[model samples]
Target: MTLAAALAAGAAQTQTQAQAQALAKLNVVAFAGASNLAIWAGQQQGIFARHGLEVALELTPNSRAMASDLYSGKYDLALTSVDNIVAYNEGQGEARLPGPSDFTAFFGVDDGMLSVMAAADVPDLAALRGKVVSVDAMTTGFAFVLREVLGQAGIADQVEWVAVGGGAQRLAALLEGKQAATLLNTPLDLAAEARGFRRLARGRDAVGAYQGIVAAARRGTLAAKRDQLIGFTRGFRESLVWLDANRAEAAGILTARANMPPPVAARAATALLDPERGIFRDLRIDEAGLRTVLRLRSKYAQPQKELTDIARYIDPSIRAATFG
Candidate 1:
């Protein structure tokens, strides 16, 4: 190669290295499922890197563990249920940790692709009564949703509750007959139905509107790294747009990442990108949805405290500054 060409190439390489070195590192934890496709896509497409962040995304199997670790400074941010933040903040968490936690949802993720699936032998919510049901946590996460669904059916007190892990673990327990019914999300729920496991009901259908996954961090972290958090949010929003615009490629990513067949992956991709129930178009915290979450938690939480205010658990300023 000519000397001029070699010099240009070396300069470009040096600039790339400098950008990488300058990136702010952030640690994140999320539940396992198709809900996190945007994060995976962001990493694969260098979205986070472009935003000046080096993000480590970990899959947390248990809600309590995710809470404990986040409280202990193991993660800078967490993509978890807003319910968890409320449960812990109110001292009603399933696995209570010592000391007060100041976690809050700064941005929204999705409407929580949650569904109740049961063994083929079980017919409906009434049948689930006196039978075992699995949840990621007994008091937090979607357990309250399940309780509301059963409660509406006049069978909440009749069923047995068990603490299974995430979607994958709950699906495994259902397949193994360890639990008669459990909640699942996205591709796993699709896969379960393909296997003839009956989808008894969807969470939205049962309980009406609710917030699902959210990007959460401690209040102190938000105060300390406001700019970095905003950058991360912007990158995540861009990733969602990219996924919507690139369906086939996104499905391929889901196929390989979730270990599903091509057809299943395609369907899962379609479901996630659906405007109605998939990822939010704008990452704004929906006040109505937050109220639904608070209402459900207030009803079923141990000690059954009335929680009416949404501001106590969510900070909209970060999202507002980033998006508006």
Candidate 2:
């Protein structure tokens, strides 16, 4: 019996080492834009480090691609859209092609700012009534959400598409005076304004349901490192808590990290942090937000689902961890 007990202890030690190696250095990724600035801030401030986590901030642009790589185990964690999470979980949109799996969301980061910017002379979102508007996304891409944004601005049917992707071409169209309007947010939008672009409606101005980024782990990771996940969330929320308390200093961190002017970073931080303008301001994956997405998707998107059905996609453990 003593010899058997010794053997069991040794096996437990080996398993512990394997688990440590698998979770030790976490490879985390997010979009390569202003929307994911909080990830940058937490890294710069060593929040992840303080929590015994080593994180790498991979720069992924295509939102779907990020979700794919993250879900397939290319990366251990990701800061990606709640929309993408729902779409993937329900086996709808692109996720349906590959079948859904069990995954969990960690934290609610920010609401996105998918906006339409145009030439200085284009009067308003209404003015884009028949003019060209380019986006990096396709039909139901961020552009679709922007349509709702434009609607709230009281001009949904006005703007037309021009096929300029969200990042550089959106700016190029404005600089070359080719497209009438394009959607963007800082520091790209900030740069555009400095170069003579006009600001139209922001996504936050368009709908109460804006894009929310999540920190997700494999469902296995949740079961294994529940405490570690809790620690990471606590550290992340602390960084956000710090941002909430020290707006000026937090803006400074983003401004320098983003290489944008102070005022530009300030405005970006404001939008990134604002409950109304920012994405993750609430951080609570409430029923209302899911209902808005589900209701709109039922109309404009295919494989339509009900809010109650999609609400199962949210784990809320991270938010609950923070509050509890």
Candidate 3:
């Protein structure tokens, strides 16, 4: 068998052994998309098992619900856009949580593989006038991205913004003609293209390097589950390494677990594996990307404050331990 397949089999065996030992349960919440391929591969390939963790992964319909759940002690960690953490922590989020925001990002994933996807018939960006666009929340997620993209295209004020939830739901709205366009990431963006959607603008092309998804947890959770978080970080890093080396296997995992067709999964795997724009192999936060994220939020966030302190949202101890 190939090395990846061998690793897969070995991981399966390790998971079996770990189950008998009653591994620690970790509840992880994330948006639904191909960005999660590594996490899924980690679960199936036994990376987490080798780390002595039993991870339960769930897809949130919206960032509001994900934030609410994460803050309420319902989930142990969240793989989400760093923007959500910033929005909530700054009191700019659409959803109000139970307590003060202590969201901390410990692992970096990718530059938001974000693109403004318009229906095929919509033609150019200028053609979107008077059309309805969708967003996860008007205040958080990639809503700022949508605004900046359309604003530069000179039609920002011509469109209506509807609060759609996650990527799957936004893609559904686009497909069903409920909304004319929205921002989408890999796989879903590929899927939207398959359905005749036009990529009017790419976030990276319009804006620049952007920190997208990251593994986040509350301060209390980080303090209490230090060991478990360490194991998770190690497993997550291993998963990224495996994914980088095993493209075909990673695509297969996306198809089987994320339920994308073979072609879409293959394209997504390729897009996600791109060295410059894909998932971060080193798993280190791109300070440049973080700055871009902060800059956009500072400009667009309501009752806005200048957010320049990167130290406030990041706790790199777990990642430092795993990589060191």
> Among these predicted structures, which one has the highest TM-score?
1
Residue pairs clashing in model 3 are none
**lDDT, model 2, position 197:** 79
TM-scores for candidates 1 onward, in order: 0.93, 0.77, 0.93
True-structure RMSD, every candidate: 2.1, 8.2, 5.2
On lDDT, the candidate that comes out on top is: 3
Q: Order the candidates by TM-score, highest first — what do you get?
A: 1, 3, 2
- Candidate with the larger TM-score of 2 and 3: 3
Instruction: Give the per-residue lDDT of model 1 (tens digit) for 43-146.
Output: 99999999889988888889888999898889999999889999989988866677888999999877778898999999888899789998887787598888
Each model's total of backbone clashes:
0, 8, 0
Candidate 2 Cα misplacement greater than 4 A, ranges:
1-23, 33-35, 95-98, 101-103, 139-141, 150-178, 185-188, 209-211, 245-248, 274-282, 304-308
Error of 1 at 302 (Å): 1.6
List clashing residue pairs in candidate 1.
none
Provide the lowest-lDDT 10-residue window in model 1.
92-101
Q: Which digits, one per residue and each the tens of the lDDT, describe model 2 over residues 180-242?
A: 877675557777786777887676556666544567766776777777777667767667766
For candidate 1, give the lDDT: 0.87
By lDDT, the better pick of 1 and 3 is: 3
